[model samples]
Target chain A: MVMRGLVCLLICLNVVGVCHDVSAGMYDEEEGAFETVSALNSDHRFWDDVRLTLSHVYAYGTSESGAIANRSSLRYEFDTTFFKRFSLRLDGRSSLYWKQDHQAGVDDTNALAQNDLRECYIQAGFDAVSFKAGKQVVVWGETDGDVINDVISPRDEREFVFTNLEDARLGQPMVSMDLYSPWGDVFVFVTLDPKVNETPAPGTRYFRGPAGIRVENEKPDTSDQESGIKWKKIFHQFDLSVMAARLRQNTGVLVYDHSDTYKKKYPSYWFYGMGARYATGSLLFTLDASLKRHYQLQTVDISGRYAGSECLMTDNALGVEYDAGGRYTLNAELTHRHIVNDQDDLAGVKQDTDGLFIQYRRLFLNDTLTCQYRFYHQFQEGHTIHNGELDYLFSDHIRVIMDYTFFRERNQRSYYWTYRNDDRISCEIRYYF
Target chain B: MKKTALICLIMVAFASAAAAGQAREIMEKVDNRNDGQTVIAHVSLTTFRYMTQNGKTRAMEQARIKRMTFVKKDEGPREKDHKSVSILREPKSEQGIGFLQYDYEEVGKETDQWMYLSALGKVKRIVAGNDNEPKTGSYFGSEFNYEDMEAYNLDDFTYTLLGPETYRDTDCWVIEAVPVLRKAKKSNYSRQILWIDKDRDMILKAVLFNRNGKKTKIIMSGNIETLDGILVPRKIVVDNVESRRRTVLLYETIVLNRPVDDEFLRVRTLTDKGYRERKLQEFKDLK
Candidate 1:
C-alpha cells in the first residue's frame, strides 16, 4: 500500500508543473499574467541549462529470504555563467528508501529519507590562470574500478559496487587553481572539509561486524586542511600526470572499547602518485601507481594481533582498453599492492596482494539500448564478483535499467564471502526533464 | 612545313600546361577561401526517413539543435590540423552530450574522436582507424556522416576541372576529386563531383560516388551569405540514394573569425557544464 502511494506521488510530481500552470490560469487573468511574468523572470535565459532527473529503483536479493529494497530519488542540476568569465554550477539530490525485513529482528527501517548537495562551485579563468572555489569532486586516475591514484575524493560505499562509481563520489569543499602553459597544466588544491568514505550501517546486509558491536566515526577537525598539487600534460601520444598530496587516511584505525563499540580515528598521511595513458589505433594502455604511508589498526586479520602498526603501502595498476567496431568496448586492469614495515606477527597486513578487473560494454539500436558486464577478482583473497546490466531508452524522457550482481569466494576467509548469499537483481526507471 | 608542325606541337604543350596550372590555382583559392582561424555556429538538423508501404510514401522526422566550434592550426607547409567540438543542446534527454574531434590534414593520419556522456558523467575516447566508418551513428540518423561534416583538405585528394557549367540558373565550376592513394585506402567514396559557385567561391552542390562507382549521395547547399568576409551556407540538404533518406541542416547563426579563447577548446569544457556554458555564452556574445 505504501509502494502504491509512492508511485502515485512520483507520477504526480513528474507532471506537477503542467498541472500547476493549467490550474493557475483557469479563472483569473491578472493572476495568470503575474505568475507568467514571475516565472519568466525567475527562469531567465541564463538558467537555460537547468536539468532535473527522477528515478525509482526496485531491488531484490536472489535468496530464500527474498529481501527487497525500494528507492526513489530526484536530482536537479543547474549551470550558468555569472560574469563574463566566471561560471557557476549547482547539483543536489533528494532520495527515499524502504527496505523489507529479511528476518524477524532485522527490520532495517532507519534513515529512510536523505538529502545531499553533491557539488556547488564557481570558477573563473584569467588568461593562463584559472581558479575554482566551493564544493567539488576531483578525480586523478586513469584505471577503471581501481583506487591507486584516485584517492583524492571520498566515496559512499553503503551500496558497495552496486552504485555507479561517479554517483558514489562525494564532493569536498576546496579551492583550486590551474596554471596553463605550453608544456603542461599545473594545478593546486586546498580542501577545507575532507569527507571520509561512508560505509554500510551496522544492521545492513553489507555491514562487516558482529551483531552486538557499534561503530563510531571520529572526523578530524576542520582546521586540519589537506592540500595537493598535480601536473598534467599530453606529450606525443601519451597523456601523463603526477600528483602529491597530504591527506587524512580514508580507512581509519579502529579502537575497540569495553562496551563493544569501535571508535574510528583518522590519521594524517602523505600520498604521491603518477599515471599515464597512451592510445594506439583502437587500443589504449594506462598505468597508475601511488604510495601512501600512515599508522592504522590491522583490521584485515581475523586474529586481533598487530592491532596498531605504522606501515607504508604502494599500489600499482596497469590497464588496457580495446574498442571494437560496432559500439563495443572492453577494458581490463591488473593491480598489485606491496606493504612495508608490517608487523611479522600480523596475518592481515600481507606483504603483497593482487586484484584484476574486467569490463565489457555493447550498445545496440542506435545507442538506445546498452548492455555491460564487469568482473572483479582479488587474487590474494580468492574472491570474485560479477555484475551485469541492461539499459533501454523507452523515449527521450524515459529509460529503464536492469542489473544483476553475483559474488563467489574460494574460501570463507575472504571478506566478500560474508555477502556470498547477498546476490541481488535490481530494476530502475528514470525520467529526465 | 616541318617548322610549322614544330610550332603547333609547342603551342599544344603550352596550352595543356596552362590548363593544369589553372586547376591547381583554382583549388588553392578554394582552400584559402574556406580556411578560418576560428568559427562558431548554431545549427538545427532535421532528418527525414522515407519509406514505401503498399505503394504509399511516408516520412518520419527527427530534429536536433547543436552548437559547434572549429579551430585550425598550421602544422607545416603542406599539413594543417583542425580541432572541433560539437555540443548537443536540444532534445533534453541528450542535453550536455558533446563530441570532440581532432582532424589532421595529412593523408593516412587518423582522426581522433571523444564523446562526453552527461548521464555517465564521463568522457569516452572513440578509437577508430579512419573517419570513413559508418559506425559514427549517421549524425542522429541523418544521411550526413561524420566525414561529410568534416572540413575538406586540398592535399588529401587530387582535383580535376571538368568544365564550366550552370547549375540551377547559377554559373558554377564543375570539378571532380579523387582521393589520393593513402586517402583512398580508408575512404569509402571513390570520387566526388562538386559544383562550386564561381562568384561566391563556395561549394553549392556535391555528388558522391561509392567505391563501386555508383552514385550514393547528393548534397545541395543554399541560402548563401557572407560573414566576416567569408562565404557561408545557411542551409544544407543531404540525400542518400540507396536508403532514400534525407537530412537538412539549417544554420541559425554563423560567426567567423571570432575571438574564441584557446582554453574553451580543451577537454574540460566537454565534461564541465559550467565551463561549457560560459564558453558558449562568450561565443554567443560575439555574434
Candidate 2:
C-alpha cells in the first residue's frame, strides 16, 4: 500500500491500468515470461509480442511547386523464443506510394506498392558464444552520421538523405558468430548474397546520368562470398575496435560499354579499418579510419562518358559529441576522403574531398518533444545541405514528425546540382499498437 | 558580559557538533544496511501529471509506463562501486534497448555508461555530461533524475539531527541534510529533510527544497518487506511539487544475493541481444 499522498498510484497501477504500454507482455522475475503473459497484463493472446505501426507521410516541394511524396506504410515486428537458448525475430514493412504531381521527374512505370522483409533471423545464445543467421543487418562504425567505416550492409539511398537512418539499410542474408572472451569480444560475419545500393531510377529527380542510356547491372562473383571480422575491447573510458573485410563495394561503379550502354559493376575491394572512442565527463570523441584497396572509380574516357579505374583511397572521420547527459546535445564531425592514386582523373570526383557536419538536439516537456537541426558542407565543391526537424509525441502510441530540408550549391559540377530544386518540407504521423 | 557571550557561543557550537556526529552515525548505519551483493529486480515505472484541489491528489488521464529488468552487482574493491545493466522489456517502440553503467565510488570520479539501440544496431558510449551546469534530465522521463538512482556518498552532505517524532505511527528521527560546497555546485536541491525509521534505519520520507529555497519534491517509501533477512522497500513514490507530476517505482519482484556473472554487466550485455536474453532468462529462473 502506498502512502496517502500516493494513493492515486495504487488505483492507477491496479484497477485503472490506463497506460497502453503496460497492456502488453511484461517480464516477471518470479513466474517467468510466458506465465506472466498468462497471469498479468491479462492478455493471453498468441500474438502478445507482436507490434504494429501505421504511418502516413507527405512531402511538398518548396522549389519545384509540386508534391514530392505521398506515401502510407505499415510496419510489423516481433520477437519470440522457441527453446531455452534460441529465439526468432521477424520485422517487415509494406508501403504504398500514390501518384504525385511531377516535380522535375516522373515515376510512370514505378510500382505503386511494395513489401519488404527487413529482418527474419534466428539466434542461439550460449555461455560465452552466440550465433545468428538469416537475413540481417550488421552495422560497423563509430561516427554518428558519417559512413566512413560502415561498409557491411548495402544502403537504399533512393530518397537521398531524407530517409530515416533506421529505414535506410537493406538487410542481406548472412551468418554471424560472436565469441565473448576475457580479453575482448570477437565477431565474424559471412554474406550468402551480396547486394548493391539502391539508387534513383532514370526518371527520378536525383538521377544524373543521360536519359535513355540503357543500364545493365553486373552480378557479383557468387563463389567469393563477402565476409568480415571485428575485434573490440574497452579499457577504462576508451573503446577500441579493429576490423577487416574482403567484400564487394555496395555502390555500383558506372562504365560506358559503347552503343549508349552503361554497365553498373560492383568490384571486389579489401577494407581495413580501426576505430576508437574516448570519453571524459560530458565529452565523447570518436575517430574512424579505413583504407580500401582496388577501389573502383569513374574516370572520363575517350568516349566522353565514364570508365572504371582501380585505385586506392582512404576515408576518415573525426567526431565529437557533447551530450551533457541532458536535454541539449551537440555533435560535430569532420570527414576527409583522399584518392592516393589519382593519376587518372576521375570524372566528377575531387582528388581530396573534406566535409564538415554538425548537429544539435534538444528535448522539452519531459522528453515529449524533440527539436534537431543538422548541417553538412563539402569544402571542395562548396555544396551544403541543411535539415531542421521537430518530433512530438501526442501520446504513448502516436507521434508526429515534421522536417524541412534545403540545399545550396556554388557550382554546377556538384552532386546536388542535379537535384538542386528538390528542397521540400515533409511531415509524418505514426500510430503504434 | 563579553566572556559569558563567547562561552555561550562555544557551548552552542559544541551541541551542534554533537548533533551532527549523532546524525552521521545514524546515516552510516542506514548506508551499511544489508542490501545484498547482487540484485535482480523487475522495475515498473509509471509517470503522470496530477493536480491538487483541496487535499486530494488526482492523476491525469494520460500516463506513461515503462518496464525493465535491472541487474546490479558490487564489483570493484570500493564498497560503493558497482556495475548495473538494464534492458527494456515493454513498450514496443523502446524494446531491445539496453544500458550498461559502471558507477565509481571515488569522489569526483565519473560513471562510464553505454547504450545500445536495436534499430541502429550499435553500442555507443555516452557521457554523464556537464555543460557549465549539471544535467537536469529526468531518468527514463520520470521525476527521478540520474542522481536519485545512484549510490550516495556520505561525504557529499552534512546531516543534522532534529530530535525524534512519530511519523506514520513509527518512531523516527528527523534529519536535515545540506550539501557541502563541492556537491552544492552540482546539486539541484538546496536542502533535504528526511524522516528516518528509528528501528530499520531507513529513510521513510524526504522533502526537498529547490536551489531557490522553494519546496520542490516529496519522496515517500512504503510497502516494506523483509526478504532474505534484509528489509527492502518495494515501492517508492516521488511527487514533484513544482510540476505537479508524480512517478511511482514499483519493484514487482526482487531476488537478492544471487550469483551474477561479471560479464552479464559488461558492454556485451547491451549489444549482444541473444546473450543478454539468455542471461535474463536465467535471472528470471533464479528463486
Give the winner by DockQ. Answer: 2
Model 1 has a DockQ score of 0.20
User: Candidate 2 overall Cα lDDT vs. reference?
Assistant: 0.79
Task: Give the number of colliding residue pairs in candidate 1.
Answer: 0
Which stretches of candidate 2 lie above 4 Å from their native place? Answer: A1-48, A101-111, A345-347, B285-287
Question: What range of 10 consecutive residues in model 1 chain A has the weakest lDDT sum?
Answer: A33-42
Clash count, one per candidate: 0, 2
List each candidate's DockQ score. Answer: 0.20, 0.41
Q: Calculate the i-RMS of every candidate, to one decimal place.
A: 11.6, 7.7
Question: Model 1 over residues B1-287: C-alpha lDDT tens digits?
Answer: 99999999999888766765766667777777754566677665555455656654345432222333333333346536777777776545677788877777765566677778776565666665433443334564357766687668787787777789998678988888888876676566889998887876778788999888999998887666677777777667676778776665665566776766656666666876555665666665433
Model 1 per-residue lDDT at B86: 79
Q: What residue pairs are clashing in model 2?
A: A282-B129, A324-B129
Q: Please give the distance, in angstroms, between residue B251's alpha carbon in candidate 2 and its true position after superposition.
A: 1.0
